[model samples]
Target: MDAAVSLLRRAEAAIPSGRGASALFAMLRPDDDPQSWRSTLNNDGAPYQIAVTDAGADASVRLIVDPFRLGRDEADRVGRNLAAFDRIAHRCSSAAAARCRRFMAALAPSFEEGCERRSGDIWLAALPGAAGVGIYVTARGRAPQIQCTRLIAAAGLDHHRAAIAAIHAYGAVEAYSIQGSRCDDLAINIYWKPRGGTPLPPAINFEPPALSPGSPPTALARAPLGAMTLCSTFAVLGSGRGSKIDLCNHCLGLDLAASLEILGRFCDLSPAFVRGAGDMLAGEDAEIAFLGVRVRPSGDRAYLYLKPAASACQSVPHLVEGATCR
Candidate 1:
């Protein structure tokens, strides 16, 4: 028998067959290829892949995971199972170790659910050692929705804290207006400066709003462009009046998009202020000005600057203290 297959059988023998235990081992069978076997008894459309190897001495086992197939919930279950096995395997005898090996063997199919649930992608690699396990996770699109305890335990408390800090530092900012019959809505317009003193486009042109206050914000909604109009009623009567200023709808969107993009990049590189940053604005009341904006890349590490619209101000600059926000 293949060493990996033999180990799986031995481990299966140790588990009692009652109270959902059968369901647990149902995904594992004697004929199942230890290298190819995956737990899909609870599959829900997502894709997942897993690989395990014996690291020898320093680390008892190394498990490589690609959770592209599994939905978020299934992926989470798989992670939980691995954690449980990590604890159980440590106490098993040589024969038991072999069986337990196949349990986590190449069972990455479980994370497929996570992929679908959050509409994101995830990749995880774990090495189980005598001291503790080492894990590396990379995800894109939506944030992982796993519990904090599991995250801290898997990635180490220090790393988890740092990740949280980074997110806090990259806050979000929103801008909108309610003019005519439109309620709080996303507005897009284009602005053009006179070239060589030639006539320029109209100073203000009202464009149809694209989004509303209750709607989810989009990338374009963050940074506006073009000739802009600020409904004075929206600015003066809105609850956030004192806190938020009005701006050319187009300019507001453009600046916000740029800031957010920069902040997102900063957070990805350093997860130090994941929780502290919030929304901010600059312009106010019918005047084409800086709207509220969120400070990001927290602490003294990063900053954003907006200069008064001048014939000379060609581009906005975002900076990381000494460095530019490019």
Candidate 2:
């Protein structure tokens, strides 16, 4: 707890302020519920991750804040979070910021507004300790594609229509990272699942993005990528962001050592320290479903995903790719 606080304070100057997500750093320490968090393994593999920005000096943290974990009603917390997001977004003056802000704002879940979001569909994050928040929206089917197209139009990303359109998978997660209203492009995480066993890297038909670390599932011979648990590979076209693809796996497995071994492939972070971070929250009865790793496309940055306890997120049904009627 002291260490996390110190780190947050050190990065405070670089980190932004004024969003519901902005409170995650502080809330995580004293009032923080360990049930919600992840450590992006850019440096040491600690449960709470903090990284310095590449573009600037801003401290960035990649994390997810589950409203339900804080012992508050989902609607009460999500409503406030979304409202806070808008308030912060409203202050974005730059065209880039405003356009990106509007795009993300559109993705907020609104059951009455036809937003197809389940209880666990909406997740929030701090983009490596930015001044803003990153809102993640999960879509189950094709209808949301049209919704995304409309959002693209609003976000002024119409030029990248073909780019976003090329993405295909069983389900996709669209993440709009708003750094206190400063946003760049859209990142769509597309994933597929096989009926049994770990999924093969080449099972899906498609080429990897340039400069990528090859396929994620096969990146490590030990724990190949498969949607067996909370895992998936995202496909993004360079159309919007000028051409870049990232392979990532956000998953929870029954085994810990295997997951750690897989995490070691992405960076030089100590396995003991990384495991300790997760250990900090582990309890005899506490469900340790928070065990997982995330891979970033750039330099293949890896993150240790952890949630102290599991939530009501319905298990995404196993995706059994049907035999192509060739």
Candidate that would win on TM-score: 2
- The runs of at least 3 residues in candidate 2 whose Cα sits more than 4 Å from the true structure, single-residue gaps closed, are 1-60, 67-81, 86-97, 113-121, 127-130, 141-145, 168-181, 184-256, 270-298, 310-326
Q: List, residue by residue over 74-124, the lDDT tens digit for candidate 2.
A: 465445545534433434435534444454446544443322221233444
lDDT of 1 by residue, 138-247 (tens): 22222333322333333223322433322222311111111111112211111112123333223222222222234333544443333222221112112221111122
Model 1 residue runs over 4 Å out of place are 1-63, 66-80, 83-131, 136-138, 143-163, 171-326
What is the C-alpha local distance difference test score of each model? Answer: 0.25, 0.36
Error of 2 at 218 (Å): 11
Candidate topping lDDT: 2
Which 10 successive residues of model 2 have the least lDDT summed?
Answer: 317-326
Candidate 2 has an lDDT of: 0.36
